[model samples]
Target: MSALPRHVSPARLPEVRWLRSSYSTGANNCVETARPSAGPWAGLVAVRDSKDPAGPALLFSPASWTRFADRIDRL
Candidate 1:
């Protein structure tokens, strides 16, 4: 199996409003997303598992996040 990428812990990351995707209908497997207040990643998006809020957050650049959204939309 391929190794997964490492991410920073959500507890260490700045606090922000974590919004659930509209597509998630109170599901346990939903993803939660938030934006950091300050850092090299300010304005960047961070995503994590809703079931594991304190777990690692996957950071993404604005452009990268847009591309990811587009890909998901296409799917």
Candidate 2:
């Protein structure tokens, strides 16, 4: 199994700075992303709902996140 966690609490990530997409509107209906700078989450991209800042943040490797973004771009 991968050593990276599937999800984490945003509250525990003090070193991460979440950012939403520039395309997002004032409604805040999009997601936010961050790169964990330390701990087990380091080097992984963290994703969470903009509406749920305190909710669980999903983790993804840089490559995986890029591939996912590529797929979305194709749509």
Candidate 3:
């Protein structure tokens, strides 16, 4: 995996509607994700901590997203 930019503050990032996985139980240790609704960031998926909304987010390409989901399903 590649490292994320260290200087970026998640709080300063654009507001996004983070959604938790439906499979997640009541635990707060779940991931939240959001995709840009419009503009240049559109189609880019942003993932971050559900427990820390202001935490750093990891950006993934569409293909990478699919591969990630597949890997998760196997776990």
Best by lDDT: 2
Clashes of each: 0, 0, 0
Question: Distance from true position, residue 48, model 2, in Å?
Answer: 0.4
- Model 3 misplaced regions, further than 4 Å: 1-8
Model 2: residues >4 Å from true position, as ranges? Answer: none
Which parts of model 1 are misplaced by more than 4 Å?
1-6
lDDT of candidate 3 over 1-75, digit per residue (tens): 444343334654566688899988887789888886665455777788788777687777778788999998899
Q: Which candidate number has the best TM-score? A: 2
- Clashes in model 3: which pairs? none
Q: What ordering of candidates by lDDT runs from best to worst?
A: 2, 1, 3
- Residue 48 in model 3: lDDT: 84
Worst 10 residues of 3 by lDDT: 1-10
lDDT of 2 by residue, 1-75 (tens): 467777888887886888999999989799999998898778889999999898999999999999999999999
Q: What TM-score do all the candidates reach, one by one?
A: 0.81, 0.91, 0.75
